[model samples]
Target: MTFAAITGWGAAMPPNVLSNADLSTFLDTNDEWITSRTGMKERRISHVGATEMATLAAKRALACAGVDAKDVDLIVFGSCSPDEQVPNSASGVQVAIGATRAASMDLNTACTSFLYSLSTANAMIRTGVVRTAIVIGVEHISPYMDWGNRNVAVLFGDGCAAVVVQATDKEEGLLGEQLGCVADARHTLRVRGMGSGYTNSGVMLGDTEWDFDGQEIFKRAVQGMVQASQAVMQKCGVTPDDIDLVVPHQANLRIIEAVVQRAGLPMDKVMLTVQRYGNMSAATVPVALNDALVEGRVKPGALILMPAFGAGLTMCSHLVRWGDRVTPIATIPDEMPASKLSALDLVNKIRDRKSQSHEASHDGLQGARLIGAK
Candidate 1:
């Protein structure tokens, strides 16, 4: 069996941060209440675009992997906040990063997206179909959030993270995985808009409303993740004691604590980033993975368990072994062009085409009016 190693990893959060106090100015909530509940004092916001954030993340990951964009064979993007309804987000990323030769696509299993992408990438690598792959988890949750309502409004932020997975002959790296979904509870948490189910009926015409069941989602998230984690641990033939690190999704501190307790793992073994960056949806896992690597918390041959749970009633866990042999990529020069060609540029190009079409339609209407007058 071909081993899949995480050769590189990187994350990107927007410069502008929305603090709890800032949220209170717009929504009816105080800093103490928000922090005590979610342990998120601030979260990143992407003013440019979700595609921009995702591209930035992919660039960094590619750099860390010591690989050029041209070297990537596949691109799998997991996202809940896609910039467009058509033309999958991964296509935009592939063009943005200059991975012209790579096959690209997107997947959405709510917050479990990154794990889902990892699983897919691992399978492709094991099947001897691809050598180098990039898996990114990005979210622009601010767009889907209901600012008027404090319940769900304060729980999200924008960010993106990417990991470079490469095929190796080593035995370590991505040892086991477990994925589960509760379709009957899909409606427990969701943003009902801009999809085929809503758009085909014209019910979501220009509407961007986010409907959620906060209590139910919170309960399910805790229970589902704990169960998934246990199953993954068993599959890997290891107990909680054998785990060197537990990187649960950065949804809420409370949820993380609950999962740790249920798993009978020490709190110190778990990594937390929600305080610095709020629930970044699918980006949460990769962000934490990058942080752990930077902090020297992960060591070669260490066993790491990553469990992610999200809005689709989705829960996934990946058991990965830290391998010693990893390629190190050189850093990009500081003088690199600021006007970088990116996926966001590609999106703007598409938008420009749409605008030209509208203008042409208007000109045609004017010509018809002139003929009628004559």
Candidate 2:
């Protein structure tokens, strides 16, 4: 059967870096507290919109694939931090990136979003639906973070990773994929508000809060990923020893190590970007894939396995044959420009916006009172 091959990959992160030391200043926690728990020193966060990060990554990915945005047949953007709650975020991405010819939409399965998109894209390509597709995992996790709470606050970062999947006759593209979801434990990690069902009364409750059971999430993620990885390996008729590299969701360092141990895979076989970028949710796997590709760790015919588990209690695994023979269209620089906003600057901006909105509402109410008096 024809398969979808990842022809290009790219990742983009905000200029601002929120280090463990910086986080400790606001919360009662210190760098050691975070590092021990998460194995993360810092994470990238966007001061700009989610579209900006996704667009930058998509551009680089398309450039690397040697294809223009106009040539894309489909675009699937995966994220929890969407541009708006009503309209899909992929539409905004399509307009911003000038991908008028491509069909587009957004998919959300929490951190497992990218893998879900990858499975769907592969099916579409195999069925002769689309020749070239762009799959992106973009998250503006900062806006959704509860900065006042240290638990969820320090665990997330904003970033985007884009990959170009194209149909190829060679067997070295996507080989096999397996997906599993545990709906019984859906509430283990979730955001409380901002949905059609919630806002139907038009009372305008504004932004919702993110709620998560950290310990429960950690346990579930580790268990789910381990099971999913084993299932995928079985389906592909390959053992852990046959795999050259394993790219996993960059949720926590401990989780990665746990899954590796359970799968009986050596630590050296795992690819990680959690230390530098923290948890970008759905963007984690692709970002790690891009990092490995740029470092020339991936070679043609190498068997690469990717697994992800996320908030829905969702899990997905992909078995791919690394196609290094096809030259990359472009490559990201070893270093990119930094972000313009600091974490403090971002906080100030949020405060200023809230203040201005409140003042404007007060003025409107006073104007209505004056009109009533007349």
Candidate 3:
């Protein structure tokens, strides 16, 4: 039977680190408070667009596979922060990497994007549609971030990661997965002033407002992830003891701990990036996956578990069997362009632009103070 194997992985993380101290400059939050609540110390702020990060990650992933971009059959860019809605972000990576013959498309289920993209590519490859594919999970959340909203402002960071999947007869790659969404709770986490609904509504494009019901989101996220993890494991006929490593979404340290406890998985077996990168929305899981391999946690023929929740209240879990290789065949030397501004400066600049763009809502957009009240 044909299966899709993960052959290579790469991550493109930004250089500028936004510390909790930097957030304290404008809000009431400090390192101790933020860390205790979310298990986050710092997160990256990108100077470049999402596609630029995506392109660099794609190049590294292709090089790691020892497969030239020209030979790639598909490029699946999973992200919510597209550079432009018309051209599509996947096409940007395709052009940048010169994947001349590859079919490219974008996929977004928010935080579950990478896993969903992996499942999509795996199905296509297994069905004999595409042979080699690059799947990416990336986000540039800083631009539209409501920097004054302490609730969410401290939880997100900018990052990108990609993995190469190819056809194999081996019993590796994704064995089973569970995907679902809670439409009823979707309203609990909505971003105002982003889509066509806010196009001409006295609100500028980047002047976003957030409706983040942390309490409700916490309950739903924990429940959804735990249930999905259990369902996927049951479907694959594997117990929590059979999972070698768990690479879960980095939303909150508390949420992760809860899911691990409820799913009967030990904390030591899970890979976490929330303490450093915060919740990068779609970038969390893939970045954590790459980090796990780098840390020598993944072994040949090992079973891996990945569970994630996203903005749509979308939830999913994937079970994968690792192949023999964990290290990359070749590591690309290319890096994302360096940033001139510090993390705080970059964030303040965004706030400056946002305030100037919408003077009427300037005070309201200061952070959660204004938006949360709305």
Candidate 4:
């Protein structure tokens, strides 16, 4: 039987850091309050576009696997914040990496995008549709974020990561996963004014306001992640103790802890990047996975569990079986240029731009007139 094996992994984090202290400059909250509540100390801000970070991550992943772009058969770019809405971001990465003969597409399921894209590529490889594929989990959320809103403003960052999965008979890639969504609860979390439904109403493209119910999101997120994690573990016939490491989405510290406790896992067994990177949405799981391997937390022939929840109230749990190799076969020197400003300054600039034009935009951005949606 054919199976998919993850042969390579790489991540790209921006040079700028946005600390909780920086957030205190404008908002009423301070470092102690933010840290005590969310377990998040800092996040990142990008000086470039989403496509650029994804391209760098793809190059590093391709090099790590010792695979050439021309040999790749598929590329799955998983992100909600792509550089362009029409052309598809996966195609941009394909061209950037010179994957001339590869088929490319984008997938967006909120924070679960990376894992879902991984499932897509794995299924295709197993069915003989594609041999080698690149799966990316990237988010450039700073641009669309409502920085003035303290509720959701402190919970996100910008980052990217990619993995190379290839056909194998070893059964060492994604063994099982439980995918689902809480559609009835979807209205609890939403970013207004992005889709054509609003842009068609004469609103600016990136102008956005968030609707976040902290209590509802927290309740639903923990329930979804815990159930999905337990279900996948049972499907794979593995218990919590069998999991070598749990690399979960870094949306909120409380959410992660709640999921782990309910799923019967230990805190020490989880790989955390929340305190440093906050929530990069779809980029969360892959970046945490990449960090695990880099920190030597991932071992040869290890069992890893990845659980995540995103907007649309989408949720999932992916169980991965590691292969014999943990080190990169090759490396790339590719990197993003250093940012010229601090995270706070960059955020301030965004706030300033929105303050100037968002009110005028908001008057028109309220209704749904998207071309394809009702």
Candidate 5:
């Protein structure tokens, strides 16, 4: 039987960091409060677009896998913040990397996007429809962020990571997965002014108002992830003790702890990045996976559990069995361009522009029935 193995992995993180102290300068929040509540000391603000970051990350992944761009047959771009909606972000990555022979598609399940993309590629590879694919989990959320609202604003950042998967005779990669969505609680974490539903409704683009019920989201996220984790492990006929590491969605420290605890896993086996990067939404799990590799935490022949939840109220857990190699075959010398602006400066500029263009119409969008509540 043919299996899909994760042969390459790379991450792109912006240089500009928006610290909690920086956030306190504008929002009615402090470092202690933000850190204690969300375990976020800082988050990245991208100087470039999401597409650029994804492309750079893909190149690195390709190099790591020692695979040429021409050999890739599929490219899956996973993100909620696309540089453009019409052309699709996957095509942009394909073009940037000169993967002229690959079929490009976009996938978004908010924070669970990467896991979903991984599953999609895994199935296609196993079915012999494709040989090599690049699955990217990326988010450039700073531009679309509702900076005026500390509730959501402080909880997200910008990042990207891509993994190269290829068909192999070895039974590695995704062994089992569970995917579900809590539609009833979807409105608890809605971002207004993003979709066509709000077009020409006096809701300016990038002028967003979040309808976030933190308590409700927290409760649902934990419950959904735990259930998915349990089911995926059971399906694979393995207990939590069989897993070597847990790389969970870094939405919040509390949520991660709650899910792991309920799954009967220990904290030492968990890989965490929330304190540094917050929630990069779709980018969270993949970036954490990359970090674990760099830290030498992912051993050869290890079994890894990834559980994540996203904005759709979407939830998923993936069971991955590692191959004999944990190190990259090659390395790419590419990196994101340096930023001239500080993270705080970038955020302030976005806030200022949004305030100027959207302040008057903000009320209309904020109170819209379709978005539920502000």
Candidate 6:
């Protein structure tokens, strides 16, 4: 039987650090309050586009696996914030990495996009549809972010990560997974004025209003993640004791604690990047996994559990068994373009641009209206 083995992994974090102190300059919250509530001290603001970050991550991942771009058969870009909606972001990465012969796809399941893309690639590789694949979990949320809203403003960051998965005879990679969604609670977390529902609804492109019920989302996220994790473990016939590491979505520190604890796992067994990076949406799990490997936390033949929830109210948990190798086979000398702007300045620029766009489109947007829906 063929199994998809994750042979390589890499992450690209932006250079700009948006500290809580910086946020406090404009918002009513301070570092201590933010830290106490969400466990966030600082987050990143990307000076580059989402595709560029994903490209850097992909190059590093391909080099780590010592696999040439020509040999790759597939590329899956998992992100909610794509650089372009039409051409698809995966194709951009494919071209950037020179993966000429590979097929490309973009997937969005909110924060669980990376895991879902991983699952997709794994299934294809196991089914003989592809031999090698690159799976990217990336998000560029800064542009669409509503800086005026303190509730959700301080909780997100921009980042990207990629992994190389190849066909293998050994029993490794994603063994079991449970994918689900609470559609009824979908309204709990939403970014209005972004999707097709608002296309002709007099909504400005950069003008967004978030429908976030924090307490309700907390309750649902924990319940969904815990249930999914338990279900996948049972499907794979593994107990909590068998899991060597837990790489979970970093939406909130409290939620992470509650989910792991409910699954009978200790905090030390989990890999956390929330305090430093906040929630990078789809990038959360893969970036945390990359950090774990870099920190020497992942061992040979290890068992890793990844659970995540996103805005579809989408939730999932995956069980991945590692192979013998934990170190990269090679390295790529790639980096992001230099940026002289501070994090606050970059954020303010985005805010100003958004404000300008809203102002310019004010009349036209007001005239636009939903045509089909009642």
Alpha-carbon TM-score of each model against the true structure:
0.87, 0.89, 0.95, 0.94, 0.95, 0.95
Estimate every model's Cα lDDT from 0 to 1: 0.78, 0.79, 0.89, 0.89, 0.91, 0.90
**Mind giving the per-residue lDDT tens digits that candidate 2 earns over 99-178?**
88999878998898988988888889999999899999988776556676787878888788899999988886778877
3 Cα displacement, candidate 2 (Å):
0.9
Per-residue alpha-carbon lDDT of candidate 6 for residues 1-374, written as tens digits (9 for 90 to 100): 99999999999999889999999888888998899999999999987778889989999999999899999999999999887777788888887778989999999998899999999999999999999999999998887788888999999999999999999999999998999999999989888877788888777777777888989989999999999999999999999999999999999999999999999999999999999999999999999999999999999999999999999899999999999999999987778776778889878876666657756343322111212214
Displacement of residue 180 (Cα, Å) in model 4 is 0.2
TM-score of 5: 0.95
Off by over 4 Å in 1: 200-206, 325-328, 333-374
Among residues 3 or more apart in sequence or in different chains, the pairs in candidate 5 whose N, CA or C atoms overlap within 3 Å are: none
lDDT per residue (tens digit) for residues 81-127 in model 1: 77755667788788878997899989898898999999999999988
In terms of lDDT, the poorest run of 10 residues in model 5 is 365-374
Q: TM-score for model 1?
A: 0.87
How much is the lDDT of residue 302 in candidate 1? 84
lDDT of 3 by residue, 38-152 (tens): 9999999987778888888888888878989998999998988777676778888888788999999999888889999999999999999999999999998888788889989
Cα RMSD, model 5: 5.6
Which ranges of candidate 3 are over 4 A from the true structure? 358-374
Candidate 6: the clashing residue pairs are none
Record all residue pairs in model 2 with backbone atoms less than 3 Å apart, i.e. clashing: 15-338, 15-339, 64-330
Ranking according to lDDT, highest score first: 5, 6, 4, 3, 2, 1
